[model samples]
Target: MYPPATRAAALALLRRGSSLNATSVALGVSRATLRGWVRNAGAYSPRVAARATCPRDRELDAGAYAHLLGLYLGDGCLSEHRKSVFALRIACDETYATLLDECVESMRAVMPNSVSRNPAPGCVHVTSYSKHWPCLFPQHGPGRKHERPIVLEPWQRESSSAIPSASSAACSTPTAAG
Candidate 1:
């Protein structure tokens, strides 16, 4: 049996979106052991119940949100998993190395606690255990965004219209020929 502190630390890490394997390694415990702690902790821990609520209420960077929105439009999707866990999956072709970097950077900029993982070949998943993910990426809907009409919320529309000047400037900046 683990000490209360050890179990708490393990649960804390898991609550913050750490994977079972990662948390187990950090706590020097087997994945099965950690899983047991998680299962038990859920029965008595407030944090388990809190997971169903929004992580935070704060303003999002318009530029970063715009970039994330663009990425989503191109190849991203938001999915709901068991126990209120939500994930944003951006499908990147393995051939485009830079695309994955961009997606990872964009996700990190928006959700610092989020960690990107490769759940499958050529796909990067940015997942969090927050109920507020839908608030940040309001593009969540019933069907594929293209098949159905994607109506943006007022804030999304405003942010999209306000894509920063730096983005436009970067596009216009001339590159030197080697």
Candidate 2:
């Protein structure tokens, strides 16, 4: 369990758009503990969801982004490490090595059967590294620089889908393909 002060700091960091991993690092707490706090803490009340509107001009230069996207999407066989790096590229021009590590761990958790070729206890990590996470995400990278992606409430997804709306345009920034 987190102390009240740590919990408060974690929530504040999260509200300020810090990634969960960022919040964990800032608070010096384990990611799992921080996640538990986020899930179970009633201290932070949910606020009205806000739609972030980008200015009319291209939020990201299309030509440059297309080139970057092509680099990653072209070969169609990007390694997990490369995909994570590519996502970091779009995310504030720097990769969050910590988050990338976590993503790899998660991929390990879901390793496919064929990759179970190894009967060792820690074999999943290797499998995850080789597997491509195509289609796991519709969007490419993490959220904007210095900020984390907002955790959409269940209602938000339904609401967003009901209308094939302009919000789609907001993601004009280049993102990873897989």
Cα RMSD (angstroms) for every candidate in the order listed = 10.5, 16.5
TM-score against truth, every candidate: 0.56, 0.25
Residue-wise C-alpha lDDT for candidate 2, range 99-160, written one tens digit per residue: 33432332333222122112223111112222123322233344332144434345334434
The best candidate in terms of TM-score: 1
Which segments of candidate 2 are over 4 A away from where they belong?
42-178
- Kindly state the number of residue pairs that clash in model 1: 0
Query: Ten-residue segment with the worst summed lDDT in candidate 2?
Result: 48-57
**Candidate number of the best lDDT:** 1
**Per-residue lDDT of candidate 1, residues 1-178 (tens digit):** 8788988888777766667777778889887787677666542223332342233344566777777777666566677755645677666555556755665776666665455556554444444334456777666767676676667788777877897531211111111110
Clashing pairs in 2: 140-176
> Which ten-residue region of model 1 has the weakest summed lDDT?
169-178
- After superposing all C-alphas onto the true structure, candidate 2 shows an RMSD in angstroms of 16.5
